[model samples]
Target chain A: MNRQFLLNLRRGFLVTVCFFVLLGIAYPLAVTGIGQAFFSSQANGSLTKNGSTLIGQQWNGPKWFQGRPDADDPMATGGTNLGPRSKTLVKDVKEQIALLKKERITPTPDLVTTSGSGVDADIAPVDAYAQVNAVAKARGLSVAAVRHLVSTQIHPAQFGFLGSPYVDVLQLNEALRTLR
Target chain B: MGFTWTIVAMIVVLAIAWRFLGAYMVSVYEGRTRWLSYIERPIYKIAGIDPDAEQSWQRYGASLIIFSGVMLLVGYMLLRLQGHLPLNPQHLPDVGPALSWNTIVSFVTNTNWQSYSGETTMSYLSQMGTLALQNFLSAAVGIAVAVALIRGFARKNSKTIGNFWVDVIRTTLYILLPIAFIVAIIFIAQGAIQTLAGPAHIHDLLNGVRQTIPRGPVASQETIKQLGTNGGGFFNANGAMPFENPTGLTNFLSMALILCIPVSLTYVFGKMVGHIRQGAAVLAVMVIIFGSWLAIGAVAEHQANPAVAAAGLSHQPTGNMEGKEVRFGDTSSAFYNITSTQTSTGSVDSANDSYTPMGGFAAMTGMMLGEVSPGGVGSGLYTILLFAIITVFIGGLMVGRTPEYLGKKIQAREVKLAAFGVLVMPITVLILTAVAVSVHAGRAGPLNAGPHGFSEILYTFTSVTNNNGSAFAGLSSNTAFYNIIETVGLLLGRFAIMVPVLALAGGLAAKNVVPASLGTFRTDKPMFIGLLIGVIMVVGALTFFPAVSLGPIVEQLSHGKFF
Candidate 1:
């Protein structure tokens, strides 16, 4: 029994190390290397840079369209797990509505409700259009031009069947920068 | 709305996969599949294992333990040395020791209960190399154990069950790999990212601030994450992240992959035992429980938050959408949350913590019910079979006859082994949860106050104990205290129950078959299926009722609901 146990242990160790080399090291590296060769932009973080530093831009001012509310920590990401009935959520929504009213823009449901990921990169087309007048005013552009820009930024549902239509906030903001 | 249609679409897809995948699995296990012999031969030769040679349950169990132990060691080494590894473009540091232990045990046991954020903590090397690799092996191990148990029932007075090495190899090479590769391709096509590039620096042109967007080979990891029932996410946001699951189709596919093997293995069980209805009976029980939980969760999630109703703001027609993806909406997200927990695949496409109190209960209770509503990949099959054995034992006692399941007589030893397997999880979860709540470190973990806070701690232990990896996501569980305790919970949760399960297989394998007669209880019938369901429900409720009551139940009640 002892002899068999030792032999089994030896076999186990050897096989595990061997399998690890095949699976843990070689396989992942090969796939990733192949991926890099074929899909460089995605593999390298779909980045469109301005200047040098990585961007953590929050679009609070009227010059750019706002995305989903982000978590407090810039590096961190999560949803606001506020129950619909919670006073905190209601207060926040009411405050958002009041602010939108001040800007003479009606708040869309998407604008006030936090997304599953607080770092949502897109907003519904309606939400995007709601901010057009303010963005037009801030950028010294015509409302028709800003609306046209929003129309250009609108992305159809993924593959035409998966999600609703939306505009990518980053892409929209990039267009805003180009306008300037 | 799209919510109801998504659920209908899911059922149709699952039903198709069930018939095809189930039949295919039967062929794979029976060695009737001809496509993979060449690859299988080389593997057996290199491992020095005789594919045809059967192993006594003792040797089989020992092999499983030793294999897992060695893999755990290899994984730990890779994680600790990840900083120096080649694929780490982010140059992340080595993991802390306790978290390392926790992670290694988590994946090795098929728990995959990630306490750390994947993008921040794991490099591409650790994510692909260590975590994803274990996803396949650990799931293979689970199926191997389950297959051994089925073999125990099939063989008549046999000295051996089956070869563990052969089972594991065939499961990975033929079953998991081909499917994962194909699914990975589909995911990539659907915009799920697959790349090796470092985190990209993006300048937010609007705010003039710089943001670094983290990216990696996510599609490849995502496939196995769902397919292997290993729920460790490529990102901390898990399947909810657009990168991990890009669209509605991916969401549907992810849910299907999580459940495919587990559901099909029931058919494999029937084919092995020479009775297809036996598989149907188990399948029915799984569907009934799973369907009921999904229904309750959907209804609860679809209702307006009572507090939201009280707030008197105009609410959207769609039900509570607070923490759910806009693409999937309420019903689909609720269904996914319940399914993930029930199957022991912890990947959440929605924030389960933000679910209504009743919806959260439905999710928690699924885990608390031992996750055998088509449980984790292979673990579900064996665990549920154990319950069936007990059910037969009970039926026998009531009718004044000897208990027989699939023609194998249930003896005193079989009963004890099954009971031990069933009882260990609750004991471990309850005891650990009590200890956690009493300690200062544990108290500091929950982010919420009141019963919801209690649910966070409770959900953590329950998820770990059942080897179900989903969490409430409201707990700060990254500290050394949680890591150590959760590790202990995961290890015991896996091997404590696993060891006895193998022992039961051995016991069953040694028993002489008694042919079914009119006096013999028919386990493949609807009545038997009902009885089996009752046994499972009673055991789950009895074992977990108090703790659950203290957590989700009271939380829901406090919110003014009876159920």
Candidate 2:
């Protein structure tokens, strides 16, 4: 029994050391080598650049768009963690509505509601039409023209089949930048 | 197609390479053991010092703490030296002092909550020496704890548990290393780049300009990354970039690799505990939860918006393809989301922020539920055990008997520890979310409108507290305020749960293993399995139901066509 225990102990120790050396050390080294050789940009965080100025990676979304009204930092991707009845959220929504009206852009359902981090609200897509009218009236344009712009500019579905018709805030803002 | 084949080939080669590596270690160790014993035959070695001795909870805990502390210091120093380090062709900026502290703590804690992007911030030396080393050690720590727990169940009145250093080393070498090696080879063949120099060169057709892509040793990190379920990426783009994931097949394979060890460990649990049924029950619960989330995400992806349909765009029969890699399609992307969320591996091929509200809800809930559906390496098993303890406690309560789990009595102390382990994350998340929404720093981040924007804030807190590093990628988390709060959340989220778990293990170690009787609840039975699943869901529901209904459910009702 004593001999057996010793043997098992020695075996376990040897196995453990060898395993770490290979997997922990060698494995990572080997993989890093491959990543460096082939897919260089991605291997190095997919960083983008323009004349020596480093921009964000293409994979990460930019935060300068109209922004999700639910959370504070629109540039950082995450949820608000607030409930629908949250007074703070309601106040923010009102402010957002006022801001959208000021910008002369109609708000989509996705634009007004809380998502992911467990807050709910009672805004619907129909609200978009109301916002469009509000924007049109403010812009001195016809409601139909406002509606047409909103519908045309929103992000269409994947191959046309996934998600509600909505505008990507970033794209819209980019277009606005060009308009400016 | 080329990408897909390359990925598949990578998976196969990784598996084979790991297996061979394991075999080699086993042989090498066996030979070493023979020589050591031959030398020690005349002298009696204390069992405590003996590598062969069964592990005790005390020793295991001590070793784990010491080893982790050393690694933390080492990783911190590496970060400090990066600006001056060699192999830094880009002359990348040095890591700031505060951020360096945060990074060290994050990696050591296995949180991998990165404040800085990889390619832009870290040099090659920093990546390999600090970040990569921590990846190995942190994962090794998880494996060590798991082995200790398994040994607790396996042993009877043992004075010593396993050697923490030995377990960490062996697990990394035998399990993680071999697998990683094989996977790296396959990844290389499949189109994953492996090199020691600058990034790949690509010419832009639109601008007729040449760009130098950043480069590093990615295959090595990617292997343990997924295997250990530590989600920090070599590049800030994570798995989404073509190099990191590369193709549809590689995506699937990487996803599988991330989940494989955690999933298989259930079988290992059963093997260790001498009960396959018990393992199956745990696995079944995990599969059920995973499957439900996948189905929800897939359907949500498949159901394109009415506006898009009106505009003549349609999602393929497979599902929604927006914000997803076309190479992998909906099926694979949806699967990736579920797997990554379930295992606490945060790598993503699609933009999670772009997922439909309902799909987003499922992903958030997956993380919020403590991610115990076969969670992170070592961490997952320990957490599942916590669930098991709770399940048995509730079972005991139902039958008006004293709670017992795996032959040990589940006393108040154990229950408290388990509860603390489970509840801490939610409490931290809720508190932080409340503070963020109520305060200026927190409220200043959203880029969307109204409740959905609020959900983004809440999701950030949830993901951070749960130690699942994937973000909605829609929030602006680069500010000083976010950096501080998130680092705090990550630290507490990891240590708070870990401390309790280790304490519970020690508590279990002290209890005498009770003999089984017919009246004793058979943990392996179907009824017990149902009870376990129920306990998990109920705890989740009770804790998150109100918050969830308020977010996704309300948002969907308000915005969804059916509503």
Candidate 3:
């Protein structure tokens, strides 16, 4: 009985080791290699550089369109769970609205609402459009020119239905920089 | 509005998948998928696993433990060595020893309780290679064990259950692979990122600040993570992250994937035991409990945070929007939170810690109910079966007769095994929670104190020991102390219960089926289902009530009254 148990144990151990090498080491390496070979852009973090600076730019400058109000930590990703009834949430939104009004831009609801992931890369169409004038004026550009550009940047709701239509804020901002 | 539609769509998709997937699995386990033998034939040959050669329960149990032990060591080594490996575009360091120990045991035990954030701590190689590989293997292991238990009930006067290796291989090839592959493709199509890319460095010309956007092979990892009920996310924000979930379609799809196999396994159980009604009965009980918790979470979350109310914000229209993704909305987030916890998938779309005190309670209690409200893939069915046996034993004692389940007499040995399997989780969770609170290290972790603090500590032990993997998010669990204690919780909670369950299968397989008489209890009847649920609830409630009282229960009462 002991011998049979031992034999099964040994075989089990051997199979585990073999499968580990096959799956744990070989499989992911192959997938990673293939991903890099074919989709190098995506496989390497989809990095798009403007001069030397990375995105996630502070939008305090009027030339930039803000994405969402995320926490200060770059690595951290999650929303402020301050409920609708939260005085803190109300205060934050109130402060944001006052600031946006000071810049002479109408703040959209999406601008004030915290995103599910704090570091949301996209903003609502209304939010983006609201900032067009501010951005155009900052760069001494025509509103029509900036509006056309923003419209081009809007990625339609995924497959046209999954999520709301929005534009990538960094990409839009990058486009603004290149505009004459 | 999107939340309501998503819920309806999710129900419709699950209802369809349950019938087809359930029926498909019946054939897969019955060895009827010969069309795939071309692939599996070489695999069986290399592994030296004879598909037809069944082993007795002792050998089967030994085989499982040995394989898990070996894989556990392999997983540990891989995590430790990931810093030197390729595909680490971020140059993330090797995992610290204690964290590595915690992580390996978490994944190996099928718990996937992540103390560290995936995007920061792990290389792409660690995520896809060791963690994702175990997601498939651990889930397959669970299904294999579950099938063995069913075989025990199906056969008469037989010492053998089934071949563990054959069961594991076939489950992976036939059930998990096809579903995960299709879902992974769908995720990619829906904009969930599949990349080998390093973290993105996009220049925001306006802000003058550099922000590094993390990227990874998210969609591929996500599919199996949910499908296998292994809840560890490639990103720390988990399914809530845009790169991971992306849209409502992916969200609905993920919840469905988390539920599909476990729900279908009920049909597999019924078909194997020659009674489809029995499977339906069990599934009904699971759905009832799960739906109740989901509803409770939604209502509680929508009621507004009282502390927020006292602070003077009123006229809220979207309900409690705090700590939730606006894209998913409050109702959907609440549903997802409850669904994830109840199913033991542990992948959260919303932070559970930020939930209203009662909302958090609803999620935690789902795990405390032994997570059998259609639990994680195989664990759900087997745990419920254990409950069924206890129910029968109780029913027998009340009526003065030897209890029987699926024709096998419910002898003392079987009853003891069932009791052990059911009681082990609660005991571990309670004891561990006690130890954690008593020690300075344990009390030191929670971000908040008072009852809410207690809830965080209690939730960790319950989540880890149950192999559920979701966290309250308020606990600072990355320390050496948490890593070690939670490692113990995951290992003991998984293997300790599994050992007795296999023994129970062996014991049942050896017994002859007794012919049904007037005194025999009908387990498939509605009355029996109620009794089984009653037994499950009573046991769960009685065992963990004190902990609940100390945590969410008191926290809820203390809300507005004190806070």
Candidate 4:
């Protein structure tokens, strides 16, 4: 048993080192090489002209179509883990609604509530359409044209039955730049 | 409709893959995947292990513990020295003492309950080297141990189970790595990012404001993160983060990855034991419990969040949206979170803390059921088998002398070991929870007040004790007190249970098989499945019932109308 114990230690040390290199170093580097080689844009975070279409950003004014209300800070992507019974959550939602009331068009639930990742990149189509009037009013473009732009930017669920159909706010705002 | 389809899609995918994956895994463990054993041979040469060596249970357990201990130290030191390590583009500083200890234990045990956010805390090297490496090894550890236990049943009066070194290496090289590689690239193609670059600094072209979006080798880490049931996130938001999970398609695929190994492991269990029905019985128990929990989670999240409703909006038709993504909506988020918790993969697409009281209950209770409804890859099969042993013992009590399962007699020693294995989780949970809630430090952990606050404390202990890494997230768990307590829980949760399981495996493997008789309690039948489920549910609910009432249950009764 004593000799077996000693042998176990030796094997453990050598095996641990062998695996750390094989799995830790070699595997990730190999995957990264493939990612950079082929899916360069997506692998590099799908970085669009407006920043990565994956991360939500703060929009200061109506010149841009706003993302979710509490969408800010990518330093640590997190959510307001407020309970459904949390008064703090209620107060925050009410404040968000008040903020949305001041904007043009209708407000949706997703616009009023924060996303699981505080940096959500997408919002429902209705939420985007709600911001069309404000974007049009701020840019001095016709609301019809701004709505058309929002419509064009909408991405349906992949493969018809996968995810929710929505629009990426960053991509939409970048597209809105082309409108007269 | 989306909810119904999501369930159907998940069930269909798992049903298609579980059998083939199970058969393939059996081959990997049984050493039939020799085509690339050229790769395995060199690893054995380096590790000084013989490919043909088999171990008694003690030797196998000793090797397993020693390997984990050395790796624990190595991982701990890596995190401490991460600031000075290469590939640290963010140049993050060393992890503090408490968090480092907490994190090493968490990863090494495959619990992956992150006390710190990933994008902020981990360097690229640390993410790739220490944490992600543990993701592979720890999961392999689980599969290895599980295969050893299955050997306990498969062999008759066998002194030796399989070799620890060979089982782990083969499982990783043949099963985990090959599958993870494919999944990682697919994840990248589906928009889950995989790059060596640091957090990207890009300006919003529309607004001219700069934001530093976090980036890493996320796709690689993520594939195993779900596939191995490790649940450690590359970012704080975990699966919710777009770069980590990407689209809804990726979301569905992630759930499939999490379920495939664990779900298929039942078939492996069946195939190894020489009777397909025996394994199929286990699979049925898992399916029933998993399906029931899925229903609860989906239905609970489908209801309009009371707080969201009380806040009053003209258009509040969509179900609970707080702490959930636009793409996942409510039902899909609940589906992902439930799948995660049910299997000891605590990764979340939505925040558990933000769910309706009942939705939160479903996720939390899944872990309280000991995560055996198609649990973690290796852990779940062994855990359910322990319950099976206990069930046979009960049957033995009723039927006079014989209480054999698959011809293995349920002696006193076997019964005690099984009881010891099953009891440790609840005992750890109760003790730590008692410590946390009574102390000021534990009291400070919750982010909300009243019942919700109480739920956070209970959830922390429950999650840690079960080694299910998903948190209520509302818990401020990074404190020295929690850091220390959680470490204790993770160790006791994983190893304490693991040692007894290995011992039980040894005992069973050493025993002579008694001939099957009419008096024997059958494990392969629907009746045995029902008994096994009853034992798990009763034990879980009875143990945690008092504590649970203070949290989600009470909050639900109050209709989320309480403070």
Q: Quick one: best TM-score, which candidate?
A: 4
Per-residue CA lDDT of candidate 1, range A1-180, in tens? 888677667767766655567666665555556556666544444456542111123676777787655552224555665543345666666776677778767666666666565555666787789888888888799999889989998777544544456677777887877874
lDDT by residue for model 4 (B471-558), tens: 9898899999999999898999899888998998888888887878766677888889999999999999899999899889899899
DockQ scores for all predicted structures:
0.36, 0.06, 0.28, 0.78
Please state the CAPRI-style docking class of candidate 3. acceptable
- Give the better candidate number (2 or 4) by TM-score: 4
Ranking by TM-score: 4, 1, 3, 2
C-alpha local distance difference test of each model: 0.79, 0.61, 0.79, 0.88
lDDT of 2 by residue, B284-355 (tens): 777677767767876775565322232233333434433454335554566677678777777666666656
Q: Cα lDDT for residue B547, model 4?
A: 88
Against the correct fold, how does model 4 do in TM-score? 0.98
Write the residue-wise lDDT of candidate 3 on B1-563 in tens digits. 55556667777887776788888988988888776687678777766677899899988888898888878887898899988988798999989999999999999888888888887999988987789889988999998999999999998899899888888878877887768766766676655667765666555445666666777777668888999999998888888876677666787788889988999999889999999998989988898888888889988878765654453444445556556664565676787778889877899987787787889889999999998999988999999999999999999999998899999999989999999999889999999999999999999998765687788899999999989999887688999999999988898888888888899999998889888887789988989988988998899889989889987787776645532
Q: Locate the minimum summed-lDDT window of 10 residues in model 2 chain B.
A: B39-48
Poorest 10 consecutive residues by lDDT, candidate 1 chain B = B305-314
Residue-level lDDT of model 1, residues B354-472, one tens digit each, is 78789988999998888799999989988998898899999999998888988888889999999989998899999999999999999999766667788889999999998888888
- For residue A101, model 4's alpha carbon misses the true position, in angstroms, by 0.8
| lDDT at residue B336 of model 4 (Cα atoms) | 94
Considering only chain A, what is the TM-score of each predicted structure? 0.83, 0.44, 0.82, 0.95
The total number of steric clashes, by the backbone 3 Å criterion, in model 4 comes to: 1
